[model samples]
Target: MEALYATTTGLLAACGVYLTLRGRTFPVVVGLTLLSYSVNLFLFSMGGLAMHGNPAVVGAGTPAADPLPQALVLTAIVIGFAMTAFVVILAMRARGDLGSDHVNGNRLDVSREDGK
Candidate 1:
Protein backbone atom coordinates (compact mmCIF):
# COMPACT_ATOMS: atom_id res chain seq x y z
CA MET A 1 0.00 0.00 0.00
CA GLU A 2 2.80 2.37 0.87
CA ALA A 3 4.65 1.53 -2.32
CA LEU A 4 1.50 2.12 -4.33
CA TYR A 5 1.05 5.55 -2.88
CA ALA A 6 4.65 6.47 -3.47
CA THR A 7 4.53 5.40 -7.11
CA THR A 8 1.25 7.19 -7.70
CA THR A 9 2.51 10.35 -6.07
CA GLY A 10 5.74 10.30 -8.03
CA LEU A 11 3.88 9.80 -11.32
CA LEU A 12 1.59 12.71 -10.57
CA ALA A 13 4.49 15.04 -9.82
CA ALA A 14 6.37 13.99 -12.92
CA CYS A 15 3.37 14.42 -15.20
CA GLY A 16 2.50 17.75 -13.62
CA VAL A 17 5.96 19.16 -14.20
CA TYR A 18 5.97 18.00 -17.79
CA LEU A 19 2.56 19.47 -18.53
CA THR A 20 3.40 22.76 -16.84
CA LEU A 21 6.23 23.39 -19.27
CA ARG A 22 3.94 23.06 -22.27
CA GLY A 23 3.21 26.11 -24.44
CA ARG A 24 -0.39 26.66 -23.35
CA THR A 25 -2.36 28.20 -20.49
CA PHE A 26 -4.82 25.37 -19.96
CA PRO A 27 -2.14 22.71 -19.64
CA VAL A 28 -0.12 24.89 -17.31
CA VAL A 29 -3.14 25.39 -15.05
CA VAL A 30 -3.90 21.68 -15.11
CA GLY A 31 -0.29 20.87 -14.36
CA LEU A 32 -0.37 23.18 -11.38
CA THR A 33 -3.44 21.40 -10.05
CA LEU A 34 -1.90 17.97 -10.63
CA LEU A 35 1.20 19.06 -8.79
CA SER A 36 -0.93 20.16 -5.85
CA TYR A 37 -2.71 16.83 -5.77
CA SER A 38 0.62 15.03 -5.86
CA VAL A 39 1.84 17.06 -2.92
CA ASN A 40 -1.31 16.30 -0.94
CA LEU A 41 -1.04 12.60 -1.72
CA PHE A 42 2.61 12.52 -0.70
CA LEU A 43 1.84 14.21 2.60
CA PHE A 44 -1.17 12.04 3.20
CA SER A 45 0.87 8.92 2.49
CA MET A 46 3.34 9.94 5.16
CA GLY A 47 0.51 9.27 7.65
CA GLY A 48 0.26 5.74 6.21
CA LEU A 49 -2.76 4.03 4.70
CA ALA A 50 -5.42 3.01 7.23
CA MET A 51 -8.46 0.85 6.75
CA HIS A 52 -11.33 3.28 7.25
CA GLY A 53 -9.88 4.49 10.52
CA ASN A 54 -8.52 7.65 11.99
CA PRO A 55 -4.79 8.05 12.39
CA ALA A 56 -5.22 9.51 15.84
CA VAL A 57 -6.45 6.21 17.27
CA VAL A 58 -3.96 3.46 17.97
CA GLY A 59 -5.02 -0.17 18.11
CA ALA A 60 -3.83 -2.91 20.40
CA GLY A 61 -0.08 -3.31 19.79
CA THR A 62 -0.25 -1.12 16.73
CA PRO A 63 0.89 2.47 16.95
CA ALA A 64 -1.20 5.03 15.14
CA ALA A 65 0.35 6.88 12.31
CA ASP A 66 1.97 10.20 13.02
CA PRO A 67 -0.52 12.96 13.64
CA LEU A 68 1.77 15.67 12.36
CA PRO A 69 1.65 14.35 8.80
CA GLN A 70 -2.12 14.28 8.87
CA ALA A 71 -2.28 17.84 10.07
CA LEU A 72 0.21 18.89 7.44
CA VAL A 73 -1.82 17.21 4.69
CA LEU A 74 -4.97 19.05 5.76
CA THR A 75 -3.15 22.34 5.69
CA ALA A 76 -1.62 21.52 2.32
CA ILE A 77 -5.00 20.68 0.81
CA VAL A 78 -6.49 24.03 1.77
CA ILE A 79 -3.46 25.92 0.54
CA GLY A 80 -3.50 23.93 -2.69
CA PHE A 81 -7.08 24.95 -3.38
CA ALA A 82 -6.20 28.60 -2.93
CA MET A 83 -3.13 28.27 -5.11
CA THR A 84 -5.06 26.55 -7.91
CA ALA A 85 -7.77 29.20 -7.84
CA PHE A 86 -5.19 31.95 -8.05
CA VAL A 87 -3.41 30.28 -10.98
CA VAL A 88 -6.67 29.79 -12.88
CA ILE A 89 -7.66 33.43 -12.46
CA LEU A 90 -4.22 34.54 -13.55
CA ALA A 91 -4.44 32.40 -16.68
CA MET A 92 -7.80 33.86 -17.55
CA ARG A 93 -6.57 37.40 -17.10
CA ALA A 94 -3.49 36.69 -19.21
CA ARG A 95 -5.56 35.25 -22.02
CA GLY A 96 -7.93 38.20 -21.94
CA ASP A 97 -5.11 40.74 -22.03
CA LEU A 98 -3.06 39.05 -24.72
CA GLY A 99 -5.97 38.12 -27.01
CA SER A 100 -4.21 34.84 -27.62
CA ASP A 101 -4.21 31.57 -25.76
CA HIS A 102 -0.87 30.31 -27.02
CA VAL A 103 2.14 30.73 -24.74
CA ASN A 104 4.55 31.76 -27.47
CA GLY A 105 4.99 35.53 -27.79
CA ASN A 106 6.29 35.13 -31.33
CA ARG A 107 3.03 33.54 -32.34
CA LEU A 108 1.23 36.69 -31.28
CA ASP A 109 3.47 38.90 -33.40
CA VAL A 110 3.29 36.75 -36.52
CA SER A 111 0.13 38.53 -37.65
CA ARG A 112 1.90 41.91 -37.56
CA GLU A 113 4.76 40.63 -39.69
CA ASP A 114 2.33 39.22 -42.24
CA GLY A 115 0.35 42.46 -42.24
CA LYS A 116 -2.82 40.61 -41.35
Candidate 2:
Protein backbone atom coordinates (compact mmCIF):
# COMPACT_ATOMS: atom_id res chain seq x y z
CA MET A 1 0.00 0.00 0.00
CA GLU A 2 2.83 2.36 0.81
CA ALA A 3 4.51 1.48 -2.48
CA LEU A 4 1.30 2.17 -4.37
CA TYR A 5 0.90 5.54 -2.70
CA ALA A 6 4.48 6.49 -3.45
CA THR A 7 4.14 5.49 -7.10
CA THR A 8 0.95 7.53 -7.50
CA THR A 9 2.51 10.56 -5.87
CA GLY A 10 5.52 10.35 -8.15
CA LEU A 11 3.37 9.96 -11.26
CA LEU A 12 1.22 12.95 -10.36
CA ALA A 13 4.25 15.15 -9.69
CA ALA A 14 5.83 14.13 -13.00
CA CYS A 15 2.68 14.83 -14.96
CA GLY A 16 2.24 18.15 -13.20
CA VAL A 17 5.76 19.23 -14.11
CA TYR A 18 5.31 18.14 -17.71
CA LEU A 19 2.14 20.14 -18.10
CA THR A 20 3.62 23.14 -16.32
CA LEU A 21 6.33 23.33 -18.95
CA ARG A 22 3.79 23.70 -21.75
CA GLY A 23 3.32 27.06 -23.46
CA ARG A 24 -0.42 27.38 -22.92
CA THR A 25 -1.89 29.06 -19.81
CA PHE A 26 -4.66 26.50 -19.27
CA PRO A 27 -2.31 23.55 -19.02
CA VAL A 28 -0.14 25.51 -16.63
CA VAL A 29 -3.09 26.12 -14.36
CA VAL A 30 -4.04 22.44 -14.47
CA GLY A 31 -0.49 21.45 -13.77
CA LEU A 32 -0.37 23.70 -10.75
CA THR A 33 -3.58 22.10 -9.50
CA LEU A 34 -2.18 18.63 -9.99
CA LEU A 35 1.02 19.58 -8.21
CA SER A 36 -0.96 20.95 -5.29
CA TYR A 37 -3.03 17.78 -5.12
CA SER A 38 0.08 15.63 -5.10
CA VAL A 39 1.49 17.66 -2.26
CA ASN A 40 -1.74 17.36 -0.33
CA LEU A 41 -1.74 13.61 -0.76
CA PHE A 42 1.80 13.35 0.45
CA LEU A 43 1.07 15.49 3.48
CA PHE A 44 -2.03 13.48 4.33
CA SER A 45 -0.17 10.20 3.96
CA MET A 46 2.27 11.38 6.60
CA GLY A 47 -0.51 11.02 9.16
CA GLY A 48 -0.17 7.27 8.68
CA LEU A 49 -2.58 4.68 7.31
CA ALA A 50 -3.25 2.25 10.06
CA MET A 51 -6.32 0.14 10.70
CA HIS A 52 -8.17 0.39 14.03
CA GLY A 53 -6.05 3.29 15.08
CA ASN A 54 -7.31 5.59 17.78
CA PRO A 55 -8.10 9.21 17.09
CA ALA A 56 -5.21 11.57 17.69
CA VAL A 57 -5.37 12.62 21.31
CA VAL A 58 -3.12 13.03 24.30
CA GLY A 59 -2.49 10.02 26.57
CA ALA A 60 -4.26 7.69 24.19
CA GLY A 61 -3.24 4.07 24.59
CA THR A 62 -1.92 2.12 21.59
CA PRO A 63 -1.36 3.67 18.14
CA ALA A 64 -2.89 6.99 17.20
CA ALA A 65 -2.64 8.73 13.82
CA ASP A 66 -1.09 12.17 13.86
CA PRO A 67 -3.69 14.84 13.28
CA LEU A 68 -1.29 17.59 12.40
CA PRO A 69 -0.84 16.44 8.80
CA GLN A 70 -4.57 16.25 8.26
CA ALA A 71 -5.06 19.79 9.52
CA LEU A 72 -2.21 21.08 7.41
CA VAL A 73 -3.52 19.41 4.29
CA LEU A 74 -6.96 20.91 4.81
CA THR A 75 -5.51 24.36 5.14
CA ALA A 76 -3.35 23.83 2.09
CA ILE A 77 -6.34 22.78 0.03
CA VAL A 78 -8.13 26.05 0.74
CA ILE A 79 -5.08 28.11 -0.05
CA GLY A 80 -4.44 26.18 -3.26
CA PHE A 81 -8.00 26.71 -4.40
CA ALA A 82 -7.76 30.42 -3.86
CA MET A 83 -4.47 30.59 -5.72
CA THR A 84 -5.86 28.63 -8.66
CA ALA A 85 -8.90 30.86 -8.89
CA PHE A 86 -6.80 33.99 -8.90
CA VAL A 87 -4.47 32.62 -11.54
CA VAL A 88 -7.36 31.58 -13.75
CA ILE A 89 -8.85 35.06 -13.58
CA LEU A 90 -5.50 36.59 -14.35
CA ALA A 91 -5.09 34.27 -17.32
CA MET A 92 -8.49 35.25 -18.66
CA ARG A 93 -7.61 38.93 -18.40
CA ALA A 94 -4.33 38.34 -20.16
CA ARG A 95 -6.04 36.43 -22.93
CA GLY A 96 -8.56 39.18 -23.43
CA ASP A 97 -5.99 41.96 -23.52
CA LEU A 98 -3.18 40.17 -25.37
CA GLY A 99 -5.37 38.02 -27.66
CA SER A 100 -3.35 34.92 -26.83
CA ASP A 101 -3.36 32.16 -24.22
CA HIS A 102 0.33 31.46 -24.45
CA VAL A 103 2.37 32.50 -21.42
CA ASN A 104 4.93 34.26 -23.63
CA GLY A 105 2.25 36.53 -25.15
CA ASN A 106 2.40 34.83 -28.56
CA ARG A 107 0.55 31.90 -30.10
CA LEU A 108 2.57 28.70 -30.35
CA ASP A 109 1.49 27.96 -33.94
CA VAL A 110 2.38 31.45 -35.11
CA SER A 111 5.76 31.35 -33.39
CA ARG A 112 6.54 27.95 -34.87
CA GLU A 113 5.52 29.10 -38.34
CA ASP A 114 7.63 32.21 -38.07
CA GLY A 115 10.59 30.10 -36.98
CA LYS A 116 10.06 27.82 -39.95
Off by over 4 Å in 1: 48-54, 57-62, 104-106, 109-116
The residue-by-residue lDDT of candidate 1 on 1-116, one tens digit each, is: 77887899999999999999987789989998899899888887765577666446646455565788888988998888998899888888877887765666445564665599
Q: Give the number of the best model, judged by TM-score.
A: 2
Q: Give lDDT tens digits, candidate 2, residues 1-116.
A: 88999999989999999999988899999999999999999999997866677887778776788889989999999999999999999999999988888887777674685695
Go through the candidates in order and give each one's C-alpha lDDT: 0.81, 0.89
**Worst window of 10 by summed lDDT in candidate 1:** 54-63
* Clash statistics: count for each candidate: 0, 0
- After superposing candidate 2, which stretches have Cα over 4 Å from the reference? 107-116
For model 1 the TM-score comes to 0.77
Please give the distance, in angstroms, between residue 85's alpha carbon in candidate 1 and its true position after superposition. Answer: 0.9
Instruction: Return the TM-score for each candidate structure.
Output: 0.77, 0.86
**Candidate 1 steric clashes:** 0
